[model samples]
Structures are given as C-alpha cells and as structure tokens.
Target chain A: MSGAGVRFDGEAPAAGEEPQSTATLAAVAEAAGVSASTVSKVLNGRSDVSPATRARVQDLLREHGYRRRGGGARQSPLLDLVFHELGSAWAMEVIRGVENVAREERLGVVLSESAGRLTPGQTWVEDVLARRPAGVILVLSDLSADQRAQFTGRGIPFVVLDPAGDLAEDVPSIGATNWQGGLAATRHLVGLGHRRIAVVGGPPTMMCSRARIDGYRAALGVAGLPVDPGLIREGDFHHEAGYAAGRELLALSDRPTAVFTGNDLQALGLYEAARELGLRIPEDLSVVGFDDLPVARWIGPPLTTVRQPLTEMAEAAARLVLDLGRGNAPVTRRVELATSLVTRSSTAPPPGS
Target chain B: MSGAGVRFDGEAPAAGEEPQSTATLAAVAEAAGVSASTVSKVLNGRSDVSPATRARVQDLLREHGYRRRGGGARQSPLLDLVFHELGSAWAMEVIRGVENVAREERLGVVLSESAGRLTPGQTWVEDVLARRPAGVILVLSDLSADQRAQFTGRGIPFVVLDPAGDLAEDVPSIGATNWQGGLAATRHLVGLGHRRIAVVGGPPTMMCSRARIDGYRAALGVAGLPVDPGLIREGDFHHEAGYAAGRELLALSDRPTAVFTGNDLQALGLYEAARELGLRIPEDLSVVGFDDLPVARWIGPPLTTVRQPLTEMAEAAARLVLDLGRGNAPVTRRVELATSLVTRSSTAPPPGS
Candidate 1:
C-alpha cells in the first residue's frame, strides 16, 4: 500500500464469498430479553448499560454472528493508531506513514499509547467504539479476544502494524523481514573476514528479535563458523542495555572483533561504551545494527543498519484496515515487507585481517 | 500549568465579567430566513447547509458572541493536537507531553499535521468542527483569523504551543526563554576565553530565532566584544543547514574557535562538518546547541545545549486550552518556561588557551 521501499513476497490467496449474517438485531434483542435500544447502546459503547446486561447482549451478538450494517455514513472520518510506547524516532516514522494515508483519505488520526501494555486499556476501546472510526492501525499493540469480538460485531476493522511478538494467524498484520535483515547484516560481517562476531539481541519475548537472532545463527552455520554461546548477549533494545552488554562483551580476554546490535539505539550505546574504553569504530571494533533510524547516519562513523521500512509498513497497515472496514476481505492475513541492509561507516574487516 | 521548568512572570489581569449572549437560535434562523433546523445544521457543521447560509449563520453567531453553553456532556472526550509537520524527535516530545495530559484527563488525542503549512487548511478546520474535541493544541502553527473566529463561535478553545513566529497579542501561547538561553550559551563560551564566537540561527521568520540572535548580540555587547556579521549564518533548524554553515565558518582564514547552534539537529550537522575537516570537538572547536534532545547525550561528545522544556511547554499548552474550554479564565494568556544551559563535553576553552 505504501508508494515506496516495500516488496510483497507472499502470493495472495483466492478471494472467497463474503459471509452473510443470518440474524437480525431484533432477534438478538428478544433472545437477550432487552430492548433493541439497549443492544444499540452496547454497540455504541454507552456507559449507561449494566455490565451483566452488556455481557449477555455481547454473547448473544457473537452467537448470532451479528454484524452491523457497513456504510461510510455510519463511520466517522477517522483512523485510530495505537502504539505500545511512543518514545523514539521509530514511532515518528509510523505516525508519518499513517498520516500519509490519512491525508489522502481525508481522515484524522486518533493516536493512543498503550503505556507499555501490549493491549490498550478498556477506556481506549470504549472511546474507539463511541467515535466509530473507519478502522484502526495498531503499532506493536493488539486487542484482546473480547475486544476483537466487540469490534467485530460493531463492524470496526483493525490491523496490527509490526507486532513486536507473535500474533494469532487470523489477525491482519504488517511487519518487516527481520530474519532476512539479520541474515544480511551477519553475512556482510562474515564476508569481511569477521569470524568472532558477537550478536546482541532484543527482548526474548519479541518474535521479531528471536527471528533475527535465529537468522544470525543460521548465517554462522552456513559460513562454517561455530556459533559461540558466550558471545551472545541480550538487551531490551535501549541504549543503556547496549552499553551494559558492550562492556560485558569487551571485557573478555578474547573479545569479538565486531558486534551486531539489536537496533540502532543499542548501536549508539555500544558506541558510547567503545568511546569510554578507547576503542575506535571499524578501525578497532566494527558494528552493525537493526532499524536504520535517522540518528544512524548522524552518529560518528555512521551506522551500517538494516532498513526496516517502518513507515511503509505502517502505511500498508492503514490501507489494509481501511480496506477491511469497507468489507474487502484481504487475500493475505499477514504481510511482511522486505528489509534491506544499508552499509555505511560502521562496519569493516578485523583489525589484524 | 506545567509542574516544572516554567516561571510565571506576568501578574494576572483582573478577571472580567462573562459576556452574555442576547440572541437565540430561533432569532438567527428568522434573520437568515431559514428554519431552526437549518441553523442547527450550520452549528453542527453539517455539509448539507448551503455555503451562503452557513456563512450568514457563522457571521450571526460571531456577532452574537454565541458561546455554546459550557459542559463536558456537549464535548467529545478528545483533545486535538495539530502540527505544522510531523517529523523528527522534536515532534515526538511534544506528542508525549500532550499524551501525558490527555491520559491524565482520560481523553483521546486526535493528531493532524498541517503538512508544513503554517496555518492548517480549511478541510482540517471542518474536520475539527465535526469532531467537537474539548480543546485543540497548535504546535508551531496558527489558525487563520476566520478559523479562530469559527472556533470562538463554536466555543472550541485552542492554544499555540511555542508559536514559531509572532502571534497576535491576544493569542494564548507557551514558549521557552530563547533570549536567555542564547545569552547563557554565548556567555558560557565567552567566559571560557573564546572571543571570536559565531552563532547559527534558525529561520529568521520565527520570533524565537530572532530573540535568540538578539540575545547573542546583547551578550556580545555586554562583554565589550564586536559582533561579526561575517561569522553569523542562518539555517532552517535542520542538520544540513548546520553542516553548510559549519563548513563555511571552518574554512574562513580567521575561523572562530567556537560556534553556538540554534538547535540540537544543527549541532549534530556541525559535528559532522568538523569530523569531515579533521577537526576534533573541544580540541579544535567548541560548540553549543539549543533544545536538549535525547540524541545530544548519545552523540560522540555529549553536546552542551539549552534545555527548552518542550514537553513541559506542550503540557502547559494542553492544560491551558482545557482550562479555557471549561470556562476558566487564565491569569495570563502567555507563558514562557525557563531554559537552562546544560554544559557537556561539546564546549571547552579556545584551542590555543
């Protein structure tokens, strides 16, 4: 859906017939022993409905496979973009991507942060329901099963953008090729005659991080180099974590000649660590990072990083959600855009080589 | 209204009596020769209303000083935050600040970018009117006179967060002490025995930039030093501008040993220029920057900069707009937060000293 910097790798599945709902609102209301207005209030997320009545109505709506009538008139000209955390240049790129789509669609973006939670709070869902946005694009965040059911019955479509961890296969999502990016980064170092390469990974809970680390190990295996368990370090994808890991790695009697970082921020931290220890980049200890953020080029010696195409991914997510909102079932539920390596000043051959 | 960094310099002008509206919807409809429903449609921003009738109604509304009865029930649980452009970590800070207030108040934030237009387009105004957010925050952007009047008639309160250029005296705004920041930065360099210091300024159209340059001139005058026009350069608060200015300044036969930049991004650009020319920070040049962005600390030599309290300013703007929306008059319409100089490794005494 993005205009640039994205390659689709998966073939679309054949389109299937749209599912027709076999139940009406009156029937559901009768079965739940509530007025039709009560069902409407629940659908609109009004807080006046009692919790027990709301729960009973929701179950009946799900059981009946009730879907609200879809049309532009019923939907507000807005798209909700929720983030796990809004802290870095990373989020800015995603926001820009969504804005690109929003501007074209003449829709406003309602932004929310989950405040470190993978799923947004109940209040956020209620607000989204009340606003009746056309669709929602979630960045590294998800909706609970009940939340998903609520939106499903109300005919609100949502697509997850670059989910940090693994998600249900049925969820519509967009992500980058982390495994390929990791393979490319490690291969470049190996081709440059780096045998003792240390790999610093992001949080273990994140599927993308695990995929990248797996790719790193796969590259080592194909290159006829033994993967050194001692050389592997884990970080939470922050500068301080990188610094701590860098110090631990460099303190060893036989430190690696190059370090592959989880992300650009970690690479920056490693830079600070190397500076404190009187080591030069490329000339002494080469480094490669993921997520070629803006600061990657501005930093001293410039970082060679994997381009994640974050903005493009976000744009794709927005487009997909809107399409779903328009009752267009996508051929593919999950799409991962291609990631490429951008080599700059951060990587070089081992000093002795 | 931020809990920190800001200082109240102006005493409150005594609160004036609230203006009372003598006209009713029926009277406006009678004057326009339209039904009461048509007047209601105009007030609700319904597109069905003819442009001629809508304009007439708006005129009557403003003429009547029609303040919609103030109440939470009439407003959506949302705050609109509009930006000139959503780029860079600078915007992320502002978004975070606004998010802080929005979360505390249990309101969603609707974000829009003017797409580099100093004033948002009419479409944005229409969308905002339709959304009926409790309040709006404009960052480095302004509303047109007509746009302001429309919001005034609708009783939608808005505040400018750090107006880039001069705004009307009546416009409520929050900004940092750019002049004092510039004075402090230049004074730091002057106190370090650097006489031939240069300053790189942001866009001349921006009032904050002008104030900082004025402060630079004042600092030079106070220290009994001559201001060199040849050493001064203008940039649009970007890295490339800083790099270009740095190159020109460094190539001069009698180059200055110290430079102060308008912002941190420019400072980073200057660092790149110095690096390319085989100049070392503090050893060959001393530099200072404005806006203590997160990257300042992560750079090679941590940058010395003026902390603009951007997040705090944004929070203040949000609070002020919400207060105005709740029919609470602000003591003062303008607020300036304190900017303090953070001395880091980027600045030192002149090379020869």
Candidate 2:
C-alpha cells in the first residue's frame, strides 16, 4: 500500500515507510464537500468562513495531509518580528506598537534581532520558514531575492517597517515622513533667526537618512540660503557619531548657531559637546532632533524635535501583515504617517541675533 | 476496508471518516528500530541524539503521526517574552540581554507588553498555549496558579524575570540584589555627610521595591540615624511620582540634604522639581537613583545611581528557561546577580557640610 493513505487504526505501520507527499487542496476540498475557494479561505484564516464550515475544512485538511508546502504539518499562531538590534528606546516604542495590535488579535509575537547587522543571515530565513509563523514584520531590514522567493513559495506574508533600503513595488511597507520631519526641524531652526545652521544626519546611503538630508537642503533652498557642504556632517544615528560631528562643527572658526540631528541620541551627544565648550542652549546654540524619544522631554533643557510616529508605524505594519496573512490585499503598498515638530526648550533665536 | 488502513493509490477517500489518535512514541521508535528513550530525546530536541539516528527517527515519527501532545502538529522554535511595559530604557536593556542569549541559542523571541498591567489576561495564556512555544520568560510579572498549571500540564517551561511578587518554592526566577543596591545608594549619600536624607521608592507591595526600602533603612541604622517616617514616600517608580515626592520633601519644614529614588525615571523627575525650585544639583541638593539606565549617563551632570544588571538577569532567565524546556531542572530555584554603585556627577556632600 502507498504510505500516503496510511491512517491511525491502533495498529503499527510497517518499518521504514514514510509519507512521500502531502495531499492537494483540491482533494481536501472534494472530501469536505466544499468548493476549493472555501478551503483556501479557511486555510488563509479569512473571517468570512462560518465556524462550522471552518471546522469541517480544518478536519478534512488535516485528514488529507494538506499542509503548507515544506512547512512541516501546521502553521504557528505567532507572528515573527525581526529587528536589526534591540538596544534603544526607539526599538521599545516600535515594540509597544506591535504588541498593542497583537494583543487585540490574540496572536503571539516572535522577536529576532539580527545582531546589529543590516541584513538577516541566510539561516534566519531557514529558521523562520521552519517555524511557519502566520506572518512576519521586519524593521529597518530587507530580504534577499532568494529569501523572498522562499517565503513566497511557502505562502508566508511579510511587511516591512521603515525599510532601510528600496523595496519592490509590491512589497507592503510602513514608515513616517522622514523628509517632512527633516524639513520641519530645519525650518524651526531657521525660523528662530539662525542663519548658519548645521545638519548632522545618519548614514548617507540609508533611505530614511538620505530623505532627511534632502529635506534639509530643500528647506534651506526655500529660504534662499546657499547649501554649505561644510555644515553637513554624516553620522551613524548614534550618540558617539553625534558627539564627534558636534565637536567638529563646534571647533570650526565659523561655527553654526543652530544644529539639527537625525535622531535623539545624536542630539544628546551634541548637547554634551556644547556643554564641554560651556555653550548655553538656545543662548549659544539652538538644537533640534528627530525621533523625539522619551529622554528628549527630560533633558536639562527639553529638546525641540520632530516626532516620528514609530509606534504607529509599527502598528500599521502589524495590521497590514495580519491582513495579508488573512488573504486580504493591502489598501496601499506604502504607508507614510505624518511627522510633527514638538517645540520644547532647546530652540531659540540665534545668539546675539 | 477500515478507514485507517486505506492506501493512497492516487484515489480520493470516502467522505465522513476521521483519523484516530496519533501514534505513540513507542510505535515510532519500534518502526525506526530505536529505543523509546531515543525517540523521546529527539522529540525534546536533546543534544544526545546522533544526526543519523535523529533523521531516521524524525522520518519514522512523521510517518506514524507522533506530534507533541496538544501542540497541534509542531512545536514552534520561538520563546514567549512578556513584559509589564515597553516604554522605558530599562525594558530595552532587558530585551537586549535576552536577545543576546537567544541569538547564541539560535532561537527566536516573541515579545508581549501587558500595558503596564501586572497580570496578563486570560486570552494571553490561551494564545501562548496555542502557539506552543518552547518556553516563556515574563518580566516583572507573575502567572496565576491556573496559568502555571496549564503551562506545566502542556510540558512548556517558563521563567520569571525580576518577579514583583513571591514565587512558588520550585519556580525558577532571575533578579538583582535590590537590597544591596539600595544600601549602596543610601550609604554613598551618608558617606558624603548627608545626615538628613529622604527616600522615594516604588509600590510597597512589590518585593524588589520593599527590599530596596529595607536596605535604605538598614543603611540609616548602621549610621546610628533614625529612619524618619516623614522622609519616606511611596511612589510608582515613574517620573511623575518622583516629581511630586520631590516637591513634598523639598517643601518640608526641615528639608533633606539628599534624596534617593527607586529608579532613574523618578530621579529625572526630581531633577525637574529641583530645577523649578531654583536648586542646583550637588551644590544645593544631592540626588541618587537606582537602575543606572542609559539615560542616567546622558542626563545633565549625569546621575549617581545603583546599577542593576537587568541585561544579565534577562540572559540568565533565558538560559534557565531554555534548560527547563529541555527537561533539565535548574541548579537553583532563584538566581540573584550582583548590583553595584556607579558614582557619577549627581551626588555630593550636603551644602553646609
């Protein structure tokens, strides 16, 4: 007898015989006396399936061995959330956002850190595919062509959160308006009567970082000010990079009166740099930061910053991935939440202006 | 023919028939020409199983339908990590520590925030059980007796991180030496000649918070000073509570020369209170905080605080749970890592000393 049809009859199977292939969806549908589309809907966890119909389809699917291709036997109820690292309050905000949605849906979340690496290793994909989660949400990371194909082949759905690089046209992604955040931060400084403003931003090649810098340039252009390459410093969106860049700008003979950083960590570093030189905030230098992390409000002089809705973006990504997992297409391929300027105590008219 | 013994023969099955219970481990082992213990070891993912034997056993187990009890069909490779909240840098530190260990073990982590609630809802347990994670790690939270019994019944392991309440004698947990941290913080202020010291601590019902307050009282007793009831206040270990408590202590007829807070967020809040009252740190009022989170170093004048190794605690909890999940009993029911005093810019002798 072929091994595929062997059932549990309280009798032992022959030694060394293995099931060759899983049964087809069509066969499972026929056995359940339901249309193939209904079976497909049930498999995708669509809400339209009645409870009785869903139960029947599930039992038939189990009996006929209709598992996802290469995904062992059953799909896990958890969703995989992958991050490049988990060291900052920024990550905590994103995590909270995802947890909010996950709680509502009663789905568990699996978190993976890529160990400060931009891209997840090949083994990461292999492990995820093996777990066969209901969906995936990747933050500031991307998948290789091969990895994408593997997930697609297995019918797994994934959504990107603030992707660090360009994504395919069809890939659903959630992010904030980095360009608007940068523009607002720069404009706030410029509005404070600062003529010589400097910008310290993240890695030059990172999409979000580039967009912020572009926005800074656009703001300066709109104000009829010439863009000075000397005032634009590239940082790694970290405190050390911000400190080093701040020190460089401060040491210059013609230092700018105002500075805008790509993120809050860098802005704090700039504050240290300014402190070391006995420069008073607002009186000596006006500073603006992005991300508006919690510490921004608690600093000596609260930081004026552009608030990126990281939590909301994370929630959107989670919701979108869940929708896609349930066989529903996204309403839009790319979602950009709004960014707003929070005026705290860090910014003022330039010194002696 | 009996439905259980039907052969594949590329034919559809008759309707309305269901498969029986999955094959037992004994049957799987017999088919694979191995001992039952060998198959059990493979199922538990123990390191003792040889690759060749494991592969053969896995194939046989698949053929016989040997799935984990109540785990649908497969056990997910993820570990559930639940927290009280994810709004603070402290939480981030813990997450980083867990990620470090999880990465080394080649396991995925699932994060959940209980939204500042002490206990997870009923659905939380149901969802976790449904996912069938290898293990679970809960931070500053506890499971109900029923929840614990459910996990135990399903053969899933769980470890508590910095549990707020007393645990069962046999439950595994990881925490810091809160009493020592408190003593060190209080002793530092005492050594600086601050006799009139005040304490702002977390909820009295929390074990760690109570330990810290006791340590504070211990340090005062060691110095032959009376523990003034007026100088001790209960807080929620949050910024707002600190600010309010600081204002109360500062407004006292006989104000304290120094104040020690339960956590860094409260310390920052005290800083604001001091600022509003035109008090200069160290010069006018000395402050000490606990849990030297990253913000403690970046804040103005930095903060003198007790350093609780949250990351290490999380790592230990991860390791302990992984061991438990593999059927290994913990070497100890409770693990307490060391805490140390990190002196920075925020503490000094009383102004008149």
At residue A315, candidate 2 shows an lDDT of: 92
What are the fnat scores of the candidates, in the order listed? 0.49, 0.47
Q: What tens-digit string does per-residue lDDT give for candidate 1 at A216-277?
A: 99999999999999999998888888899999998889999999999999999999999999
Against the native chain B, each candidate's TM-score is: 0.88, 0.80
lDDT of each: 0.84, 0.80
**lDDT for B56 (candidate 1):** 91
Name the runs in model 2 displaced over 4 angstroms. Answer: A1-74, B1-74
lDDT of 1 by residue, B1-353 (tens): 11121111111111221334324766788888888778776765556777788889888776665666532344667889999988889999999999999888777799999988889987788788877788999998998776787787677889998888779878899999999999999999999999999999999988899889888999999999999999899989888999999999999999999999999999999999999999999889999999999999989899999999999999999888888877677899899999999999999889879
TM-score for predicted model 2 compared with the true structure: 0.81
What is candidate 2's lDDT per residue for B1-353, written digit by digit as tens?
01121111121112221234224666777888998778655554444677688778777766765445533123456678898777788988988888888777666788887777777765676667655666899999888765675566456789999989988887789999999989999999999999999999999878999999999999999999999999999989889999999999999989998999999999999998998888999888999999999889888878999999998899999888877766566679699999999999889889977
Which candidate wins on TM-score? 1
